[model samples]
Target: MAYKPPTRAGATVYVWSNYSLQERDRRWKAVRESGAKAGFDCIFVPLGDGIDARYLTQLRCSSVVLPTDGRPPIIIADRSSSNTWAPEPWQTSREWSEPMAEALLELGMERARIGVAGLKGGRVSHVTSIDGVVNHGAFAAVMRRLPNARFEEATDILGFARYIKSAEEIASMRKAVEIAEAGLAELAAAARSGVDAAALYARVMARMLELGAEYFPWALTLGMSDGSDAKRFTDPPLGRRLKANSLAQTEMIAVFGTQIAEEDQAVLLGPIPEAWKPVVARQREIFDEGVKLLTPGRSCAELLEFSKSVAEKGGMKAKVRLVGRGAGDDGPVIGAMTQPDALKELTVEKNTLWLWRPTVTGADGKTRFTWGGTVLVTEKDGELLSKRAHGAISVA
Candidate 1:
C-alpha cells in the first residue's frame, strides 16, 4: 500500500500522528460509543501509560480523559511544549491531580461514572507491561479529589475499538514495515560481508532512523551460536564474530510515528547441514499456508487448532508465543498470552496486524530455519508486508 498525506481543509494542522482531524473525530466518537456501552460517563487515559489517550488526542504523548456526553475531553501536558499539532476539542491541565480534578468537576463529572484505562487491562488492551500500566499516584490523587465520582477499571472501552484498525492505521503500519525492512536489508548485507556484531547492530538502527523511522523501540541479537538457543547478550557484541557454523540474527522492531513493524533475519555463518534441509522446506510451507488462513471472520480457536494439527503432521512445536501471536496497534487487541480462552472467542477482523514467525527446528531443537514478517489481515488472506526474501539466508 502507498502512503497518503493527510489533509486538513484550511485548518491549523497539529503535526500529530499523520491522521486527519476527521479521523480524530471518527475515533473519539467511537470511543464515546464504546464508553456508553460500558455504562461509563467518561474514559480516563493516564500519563506514561495512556496509549489510548494518544490514540484519541493524536498528541505525541497524551494525558486524555474522554467524556461520553459529547463535552470536551481533558488533557494534561507541559504548557511549554511546542511544535505540537495538538487537537482542538479538548481542555488541558498541567498535571493529573489538583487541576485535573478541578477540570473534572467543572465538566459536571464530579460524581459521574469514570472508566479508567490500564487499571486492570493488562490482559485485554495495549495496557502492557500487560499488568497495569496506569500510574497509581495520579489515579489515587484524582480519586481523593473526586471522592464522590465512581471510577472503574475499563480498558475495554478502548480495547474493543482498537481491535478494529482503520485504513489510516494500516497505511502508517506499512510505512513502519518499510523502515524496518530497510534496516533488515542492511544487516543481511553486512552479515554476509563480515561486520562486527556491535557495529552491525548499531548500523541497522542508524539506517532505520536515517530512513525516517521514529524509534528503534526494543530488541537486538547478534551472536554466533551453533544451536537454536537465542543467546540474548547483556554485554555488548564486542567480539562476537559472524564466522562459520554460527548465526547472526535479530528480531528487529522498527517504529514509524506510533506504528511498529517487526521482522526476523538470520545470516547463516556456514553451509546448510544435510539433516536440516527437509525441516526447513516443511516449515516454510507451513508458514506460507498458515498466513493465508489469517483471514477475516476466522475464529481464534479454529486457527489455534489448525496450527496444532499442522504442527503434528510436520513434527513442529505448536507454541502459541512463537508460532503466531498478535493484533498489535493494527489488529487483535484482546490477545492475552496468559489466557487462551479469550483468544478462542477472538474473531479475526479485517485490517488487524500481527507478527507471524514460523520456525523449522532440527533434531537438536536448536537450529531454527524459518521466516518471520509482519502480516496484515485482509478480506482474502494475510498479506506479508515485507519486501525481504521469504526464507533463511544461507551463505557459503
Candidate 2:
C-alpha cells in the first residue's frame, strides 16, 4: 500500500529535542490529522536533532518555533526511563533545555505554560529507571525554566500516542508489517536441520535491514518457551541454541520511516510438537471468542468477564491482564480490559485500533500457544491489521 499523509494535522507541536531525522519526520507525518486539528502549521526541528534548518525552511511551516520570535516561551522537555539499551547523550547536556526554551519564546510561544511529560517504562526495581534511562532531573530543570508550566506524567507517551493513529500512521504500520512478513518468510525458508537460534536471528535481522528497516525495535527470542517465560519476550543477542524439533517464537519490531511496527509469530521447525496440538486448538477457540466479544457499546469489564468464562472452559490458566491492547504511537498499547485500572472503558469507538492476544498454559505447564492480531474497531465491525490464519499452526 502506498503512504498517504494524514487528512488532519497537529497543534503547533515542536520536535525540539534530540531525535534522529527519520524518527522525527515519521512522527510528524503519521499524526497529521491530530496535528491539523491542533493548528499544526510548522514543525520546529532544531538544528541539533540532525535536521538542517536551511533544508527545513524550504518545507511548509506556519512559523519556526525558534528563539527569534521573541514571546513568552513554553518549553517541553522529554525524557524516558525505559528499557532502551543506549543513553541518548545529546539529551543530558545541561545547556540543551535553556536554548530550546529561548527558541520557543522567540518563536512567539507563550512561555507561561511550558509543559513536560515523563515516562517510566515497566520497571520492577524499587527506586527508579528501566534498563538505566532516567530523566527526573531533566524534567525538573525544564519546570524551573517556566515556573507556571503545567505537566503530565505518562509511563509511555509514544505507547499512548500509537493508539490514536492517523491514516498516515496506519499506512506506516502496514509498510512495517510487510517488511516484517518478508523478513520472516525469508527466515523460514533458510531454516536448516540444525540451525542455532543466534544464527536464525542474525539472518532474519539482516533480511529486515535489507527490506529497509533501520533498527530492530525488540530483540528476537527463540525456543520452546511458554508464555510465562515470555516476560522477557524481547532480549538482546545471545548464544541460545535451537533444538532440532523446537518451536521458534519471535517478537520483534521493524523501524521504518518514523513508525515501528510490532510483529510476533511462531514456527514449527521440523515436526509439530505433540504437546502443542491441543494447545494450539485452545488458542484458536480463545481467539474466536475474543473477536466475537468485540462489538460496539460493550463495556470493557463486561467483555473481560465473558473472556474469563471462555478461558476457564478451555482449562487454561487464563489471566485477563494479558488480553488485547491499543497499538498506535510507540507500538502496541498493551493491557487487559479486565484489569481494575483499565486504560479506557470498552465502548469501542469508530476507527479505534486495537491489538488483542489471548494465551493459555499447556498440560506441560507453559504458555506454548497463543494468538493475537491488530484490528480496527469500526462502527460496523472489527477489521484485522496484520492478518494471520486461525486454527492452523504455521508449519515451516
Best by TM-score: 1
Best by lDDT: 1
RMSD of each: 6.7, 10.4
RMSD of 2: 10.4
TM-score of each: 0.85, 0.64
List ranges where model 1 is wrong by over 4 Å: 1-16, 82-95, 122-124, 127-130, 192-194, 228-230, 233-236, 314-338
- What are the Cα lDDT values of the candidates? 0.66, 0.46
Candidate 1: lDDT over CA atoms? Answer: 0.66
lDDT of 2 by residue, 286-314 (tens): 76666665666666656656656765545
Enumerate clash totals for all models, in the order shown.
Answer: 6, 25
TM-score quality measure for candidate 2: 0.64
